[model samples]
Target: MSIAKRPNPLFRNLNAKIAALPMIATTLVVFLGCSIWTVIYSFSKSRALPVNEFVGFAQYERLFRTSRWLISLENIVIYGVLSLLISFVIGFILAALIDQKIRFEDTFRTIYLYPFALSFIVTGIVWQWILNPSLGIQETVRSWGFENFTFDLIANRGTVLYALLIAGIWQGTGFVMVLMLAGIRGVDREIWNAARIDGIPVWKTYLFVIVPMMRGVMVTTLVIVAAGIVKLYDLVVAMTQGGPGIASEVPAKYVYDFMFARANVGQALAASTVMLTTVLIILIPWVYLEYGKKKAQR
Candidate 1:
């Protein structure tokens, strides 16, 4: 007969806890603390800087009513949706095709991923030149033979966002492909063999089995691409300068303009709060579902 000894939870993994203290403190102080501060200031009528006087939701009201802010919201939503869908489809397709173990695989992969190494500013500038009416694709095609070639998507206000979309896809698809490829490769060899034994077509197997199994990877890629879309300022600035009359304005640019240019910290914080809410809306559910499932399984 022996007394059962219970382990103290607080002392468990003490070394790991000590190692993580710096990061935890940084996250709490830098990220969480600043977020709360921003939210508090958002409700205040801060003109040049943060102040204590509460203004209710006047900043929010003005933010919503502003035409530029509204346009920015609409643009980001459209860009985010289109970019996510297109990147996912194109990336998965490329990954699947490459997974067939073709020759020159390394070469093709390097070629695809090379663009991803370039910064968004560089990508935007390069694409800006390529889409130029006189010096880019249009000029090259016209020089060859087609005198009526007009491949200038960047110039037209109606199609400028699409131009940005093209540049974004070119820059990001490689990384997405790499992620999807890793996920696809990670599927057990036994699973593939079993699917084959069951006489499942390759496309069917991929569509039904592999895609469903790779949900986690897909979600990760979605969050990355969605975050990029939400913070779409530098690209627009470098390429279009929100040109053709604010045709490609985005929320990030709106925040910057309000904060620095207009000197309206409250309005900027209000806009910032909206962006933060948008991100949290997408993030919270994913985290809940993912971790909840893992914890339940454990």
Candidate 2:
């Protein structure tokens, strides 16, 4: 008879654990710790400098009551929904078109993705010029036989967010296209063969089969695009500057202005907390459902 020994769990994968220490420490200290601190300070009446005095929900109430903040919230909803819809629609369309193995595939891909290389600020400035009435699309069209052509969308308050969307879609659609292309290409070749054998229409196969299989990629792309929408500040700054009277204001800008410009740390933190809550609300339920489905499949 021989004695058997059990392995110690703590010592298992010791090298990997050591390698991950820095990242774990950083996440705990920077993200978790700072989040707790912000939440704690948010309940206090902190101004330019933080104070210990507790003030309950005054900050939140004040934040909600402000007209500018309300307007910013409305802008975010409109921009967020439209941006998500358009990006996915145009991106998937472009990806599906290019996936046909057509001639000049590389050229078309490069043309589509080229705009993604430009920074948002640069893209905003370029679009600002293109949308300018005096020198851009409007002017060019007017210079032709018709002098009545007007293509200005950036100047009007009602249509200004749409102008921002036009620039955003131009800059971001390429990225979404690349992601969708990768996901579509990653679908198992056998699935396509099976669909073909079953005589399933191409559109139905894509709509019912491929889209379901690409949920992982879609989730990743959704998170990235959603983050961009939530932090929509630089583009608005470069193009509109919340102009036409705060028409393009976003939550991030509201937090910044409160923290820096107004020197109301508590109010800013309250705003920041609400922003975090908003992101969680948008993501948590979908993620939970995905997890449930995966567990059930397993």
Candidate 3:
């Protein structure tokens, strides 16, 4: 008698695969297809609409030479770098504080995390009001006897990006704190006890022992924050409107204006392609290294 043959691997999950075909196809068509189209058209010179005739890197050359684009890049770099450093440091501190099992722990966490629940638009609007020189902090302070005090960070081009940075950090730190708290809680209890037995300071325990174990969670948080930084559009729109002379403009805003308002499709797509390339450059190596390590471990 012949033995029964094994089922084909491709057919093992055939039903599930069939059910997922629509989603897979949608992603391939809607996202991947559009992205490929954008990249291809970026090489062509176009206005008011995309032109099929290729002009090579002319769009990219103009994009780099544009003063507004250069200013936007500088603003994003400063905002991104500071946001990364400040959020990580403050989030870790807040998480460590909460992990001490302080009284009213739940209340404290809720208060700290409340801001994160608000959308970026709301956050930017709220901060814009608070930073308004004539009506907000400066007015309030002047009324209270500091008449000569000036707080116009949002109006001045030099300090406007930092104003955005402050709002960004305020709205984001709570989420970062929660992620860090989860990582802290996931650390082994035995390790905490061991540190205590060795008479290690609380801060030392966190700095040396607990943090090293939370590397995975930290990496995940960093990736999320970096992605948000790359797409810095809504908050800038809601708050500054790329004002103070486009000092607060970011890449996403640049792409939006070029595509819709200016109708320069070629330059718009070129900027988008550059943004996509930057993201892939950052993420591909991270994915390879992280997953490669996991596969080796297994």
Candidate 4:
């Protein structure tokens, strides 16, 4: 009698799966595993290092009550909202304007996008010098017989965040512009022809038809920019160092300070968990609507 053959259990792309095993293992062990550990330790009373003393929400209570943490929360909210709105608008506008077949298109695109090649630290330092009251914009303007010019927002408590906002936009909007331009280019030429045939104005076409069709690109951009806003630390450190008396503090900086400077690992982990939860809350619905439904449909 002939023996029955054993069937292969793995997927057809066995080689590809094997190749990805290292990365898969890394993701599970490093990212997911560390995240779970951090969340667990956030409830502890650890100091100097992670421990298991079990604090029972006491760390979180102190976190919320702390003035620095509260200020950081408020600053991040303001920064996130304003940065998203301004960057989206400016980027889309730049992309659209460049799409008009303007002269030296490549040159203009290079200039617009070059800033994105620089790191946030570099951008922050450069802008810090440019915005410095004694040696930068204000000084130059004053020398130009405009001594009454008082453009010292970076040094002022009430307006330091906006100064950070300006530097952020200058550095990031270029990348957004490039993304928006790609999305705009991906639009069907047939749609534009039809819009023109119907005597629709170019502005109206973009505002009504083009933008709505680029929903995927817009959502992707929003997610990326929002993530950067949430994890804002380097730029603030390089530029303001959360200065002007904690006016420009942000959550990521707070976590860093607590973890390293103060040696309060438990409190740092707690604050980090809060930040992670905030991000998940914003992302989960979007991910479900965007990708989950498609998987279900498939």
Candidate 5:
């Protein structure tokens, strides 16, 4: 017996159409709707109760004039840059070390990557405890006949940012290590063999050849780190609560305080809008360049 096979064009098209409908609806309803709502809210005279009365740019004016907002913006830039640079450096070093055909490689890799699995809340608290003046390293060292011991960045206004940077680097370096290691492993082994044959020092080969070859992965790592910086909230909250005064206040925490604690939704929304705009300003060009590269490849 011979069986007849039939191609159903309509069914395939219908399936494709159905598959896309949910995504389209979700984008419109969830993302676009929320964006529009937020924009609308930013213009209102809303306080604890969101009033429908439109107030034009009053909220934005207030937001721009706020010293806290300005400081938060500055802090974000400082934190983002420092965190990205430090994390990248540490991660690269750890990855390179681990890639050297070491024993217990998996164990070491897992140990390094373990921080990425932890919530910032937990990590931040642990770091905070470790950095605390009375209970942590400073006190311990002081007790050990080092009366002049001083690691009080957490309590100092000028150096608290560095303390946060230390915590951020500790938390984020692991992920960077994993990404960089993967990039390193994906590199052609023949290149290493060739370098070995040429008597090129491993360090020189890494610096001159391997590092340059990992540009895509490096960029990926940078973008991820940048996103983390932009959305930096949990760690700041858990560790400092933007404390020792508003010295360490970040934009996200500023927004949160205005939104809920201070009952100023309009200002909060304005701050949030500013953050969104800033992120776009920074990311859009990079994203476009990446997109263009992919398109050219295609």
Candidate 6:
């Protein structure tokens, strides 16, 4: 008797899925696994090597008590808030201006977006040079009979953070522009026509109608900017090296110096854990709100 033939399940085409599996596995193994391991290490008395000895909350205690760590945390909040606000404002303005049917639209767009393509390493050096009092704009302007001009924020203890803000806004506003421009482009043409018919000023239309409608984009932009804030290390390192005596220190740099430079793995891990927790605290609420909004829409 002939056996009944069945289709071969193993022969089904899963080439795309198979191809993606390795990348997915690598990301989980490297990124997620390392994160878990780091969190665990924070609880232990790990030094030059990751030790298994448990020392519950001691590292955290030390981290909190340290003045430099506290300063770094404060600086992070200031930088994060100011950078986000400034970048958003500048990006919105640029997007609005570019949307005005200006000449050389592509050229202006490219010029604005080019900074986002650069690594912070390059931008940081350029900014440092530009902000340097003796060698850069201040000196050059002073040479040209503008001796009273004072752009020495970079050298001032109280104002160095604002220098960072300037650099950060320059680097990040481009990305904000791209995001906001996309949102602006996606806006219904009919809305603009209706606004014109009602004799509403362009600025009023954007403030009252366009911006309110782009709340989703705004939130997404904020999240993107927040991620940059949480991981702010490279720019500080390249620009100031946390110097003029910890004047420009940030949390990531604090973690790095402790981890590799000082060989204080436990403290480093504690600092990292704090950073991770702070990001989660900020992100979770935003995510939940977005999810609820989407659900309500459905």
TM-score of each candidate structure, all chains considered together: 0.92, 0.89, 0.94, 0.94, 0.90, 0.91
The whole-model lDDT of each prediction reads 0.91, 0.90, 0.91, 0.93, 0.89, 0.90
CA deviation > 4 Å runs, candidate 3? 1-14
What would you estimate as the lDDT of candidate 3? 0.91
Off by over 4 Å in 4: 1-18
Q: Assess the local accuracy of residue 170 in candidate 1 as a C-alpha lDDT between 0 and 100.
A: 95
lDDT (Cα) of model 4: 0.93
Give me candidate 6's TM-score against the actual structure.
0.91
Residues 31-53, model 1: lDDT tens digits: 99999999999999999988999
Worst 10 residues of 2 by lDDT: 1-10
- Model 2, 37-128: lDDT tens digits are 88889899999988999899988899899988998899999999999999999999899889888999999999999999988899989999
By lDDT, who's the top model here?
4
Candidate 4, residues 31-92, lDDT tens digits: the string is: 89989999999999898998868978999999999999999999999999999999999999
**Cα lDDT, model 3, residue 219:** 88
Model 1 lowest lDDT segment of ten: 1-10
Alpha-carbon runs more than 4 Å astray in model 1: 1-21
Which lDDT tens digits does candidate 6 get at residues 3-59? Answer: 236535554556876888888888898878988888888999888878999999988
Displacement of the residue 180 alpha carbon in candidate 4, Å: 0.8
- Better model by TM-score, 1 or 4? 4
Summarize candidate 3's per-residue lDDT along 89-187 as a digit string, tens digits: 999999999988799999999998998989989999999999999899989999999989998999998999988998999999999999999999998
Can you give the lDDT of residue 270 in candidate 5? 88
Error of 5 at 223 (Å): 1.2
